[model samples]
Target: MGSAAADALLPLDASRFAAESCAVVDFLEVYYRDIESYPVWPDAEPGHLRTLLPDMPPEDGESVDVILEDVRRHIIPGLTHWQSPNFFAYYPMNASTAGFAGQMLSTGLNVLPFMWAASPAATELEGVVVDWMARLVGLPECFLFSGGGGGVLHGSTCEAVVCTLAAARDRALSNLGHEAILRLVVYASDQSHYTFQKGARIVGIPPSNFRVIPTLAGSAYGLTADSVHEAVKADVADGLVPLYLCTTVGTTGLGAVDPVRDLGEVARQYGMWLHIDAAYAGSALICPEFKDYIDGAELADSVSMNPHKWFLTNMNCCCLWVVSPALLTSALSSNPEYLNNVGGEGAAEVVNYKDWQIALSHPFRAMKLWLVLRRYGVAGMRAYIRRHVDMAKWFETMLEADERFEVVVPRRFSLVTFRLRPRHEGRDDMEALNRKLLVAINGSGRAFMTHFVVDNKFVIRMVVGAAMTEMRHVQDAWELVQDKAKEVQATP
Candidate 1:
């Protein structure tokens, strides 16, 4: 009776399972090939998706064909199509077919790579890919495992910053216990991403201890070493311990780059942990000319960069390298009975990634990164980056030529920040007009862009690195911006 019941519940045969999987693969292939690009924003409203999906689970399992049909009808139309070439908002979150295929293969394998013994190839591939990335970015040898330090791949730069801050906190507490280090201070520029402060808060650092250094208006929006030094000195004078300094190779708002070499010197004098958050601009270091932005990176105790941002990889891949692995491991390491294995006999013979960050069951993401690097060799990656940088400069030139628009920040990397010039009468209301123009431009849906508030004025940001973006797309985006500006200005 049990055997008969099992037979009734199961599919016809194993062949049926194989056929279903193949059908799904074929559907995905056709879907990806045919619907390559879609509008960034759908014409439908928020409730459109919910209305299409069933409110309750089906009484019986549906056929694969029915599920595929539902996916095509309901889900496909609702997606924002981030891979679309017309997407120029924020930083590039582009993915290549190669990377996607790698992800697919990883999913098929479905291995939990928490330890080296769990999946040897996965662990080793992570080590090798990170080393390759470190070399491409011209990181110091000290950050490589071979040179006493190592790297790990986290989900985002936020996690990287938090983990590094935790390590820095532990190191400081080792010298001055947690109770004594209550007055520990951290520093970052006002232009820095809010993630730095968020990280500080997660690690128990008080808001008062976080210093937002000031950036001069004419200084390309970079954090000056003098300001950082002065802030540290003031904190010390007030009997506060200066623990860490977070510098940005490229700020989120305007692609501002803090002076790394100078900041490195300041951090050294204060014995502070210097962690460079190069999440956006770090990929450009693969090109020889851009390496100068991180000249003093060697002095940094830790650094993080997101390959998923600029490289042709998908989202959720950030590489964090430390000058001392022991420091990071010590802060996050934990031991448990079931986790202990024969391979982990000696204290130095284990590598359990669960201790590194805030999660345990991480997807096998390193495979896609390895595939991206292998498929697109170092030269190929650099070429892609160079194209974006060149296009950004072209956009800057176009803005400069149009005497009506003013480039708000210095053009660094692939991000161009500009706004329409004040109405020639120098009216204080020009900022509001520019904000309206930005809204109109994005509302059109033909193109997508984002705006940032700089010095209390709204400026539209043009980020040009959508894997498939070409000179033609850049031209179209700029034309859209100009036309929208004209339309908005014509009103009243």
Candidate 2:
């Protein structure tokens, strides 16, 4: 190669790589150390980041030192520090040293294990880790590879839902004929994630066939078997086939848990697929006390949960297990001349995860979960979860002590939903007041929280599951909330 051509090529020298890697690690360490000093939510508005950089890609590669400086000055300010202990908005995106190390290893290797033979070790490791997770969470053997069922990792619960729904849809259509696709129906409570409806639409289930069963505040937002049964009965009477039923364990808004066992029975009556989305609450099931929440998971056709939510794993890792792998593979598997058929004759022995999800290309996400499990053993993880739950209880106790605020719903897991009590008589606009209070709190940048409206009432949701969150941080957040509440209340 010519000197200029060689110079233009990206550097792969071992020494330089190591130095740059170390520098990046140093920057990460400093960021972690000082994360609490920064705002949980950034003050930047839309299109603010475009002004920080040139419109075009860099003409030449720059040193890591220079790039790191740019990240500190320009990028960091715009980022919402999801890792900050003060961040209580949405669900926690937990990260740990071990998970980060696994991420680095995966990035460095950059191998795609779409098929078993594409990367044997990667595929085998994924099987091992997913099995380990299933066992740790006390899942039934029916959901394990050893028991004829298996699991695959997807980037998010939405992808998992889409894949499972496709499987269910195809299975029903196969029996009822393709013409029945228009008549196939899907069901979920109103509190269920919107992903189910999106999945239904993607899988060709008609919009009118999507049934949203309403739950009452009297039932604490839990989806009851009677509601699902009634919905299914109505659909069946209308000549629509019930193809799928989705239940939630720790719903997003109020942390409501659908009665899985009863709902499973209702689904079984009509031969409908039962899916349990335990995205945020599944990690808590590793603790024995929370096991009852998923007592009927064995009856589920497929179960999905996001390890990225609260399992101390980094961004984007969802584990999905199914009682029947053939259904998923039949619906999603695609083989072409360009792609090698690794599982030639005895395909049952091999697991090509590419067939079990929506995407053909996937990263080594199981590595991070494996690392998190190994680094923090089942006992350690249980303790971590317990600490967060205890802190949430502490926060709830504080809220109860104050007459100005009311707990909107019973505390479930580590999420506490509460709102200020109405101070005036004959007022129906407390929603506006609560909205203003939430705005003031978020605007202050002391701590960040998000709101949810349940049963015509607005409530602030405080999730205490960040890896670095401790009792002190929770206390500080409560104090900030109290101060903000007073300021908002004094306004009129």
Residues 324-422, candidate 1, lDDT per residue (tens digit)? 888887888777777776774464644567667766665678898988988999999999999999999999999999988999987989999998876
Shift of residue 63 alpha carbon in model 2, Å: 1.3
What TM-scores do the predictions have? 0.93, 0.97
Residues 1-492, model 2: lDDT tens digits? 566866777677778889999999999999999998887788998999898899987666677899999999999988889988888989998899988988988888888888887887888899999999899888999999999899998999989999999999889988889999999999999999998999899989888889999999888899999988888888889898999999999999989999899999988989999999999999999998988989888789999988899999998899999999999999999988777753542666778878988889978887888888988898899999999999999999999999989998899899999998767745636887789889988888778999988778888999999999989999999988888888877787
lDDT of each prediction vs. the true structure?
0.85, 0.90
Clashes (backbone N, CA, C under 3 Å), per candidate, total 0, 0
What would the C-alpha RMSD of candidate 2 be, to one decimal place?
Answer: 1.7
What's the residue-level lDDT of 329 in candidate 1?
78
Top lDDT model: 2
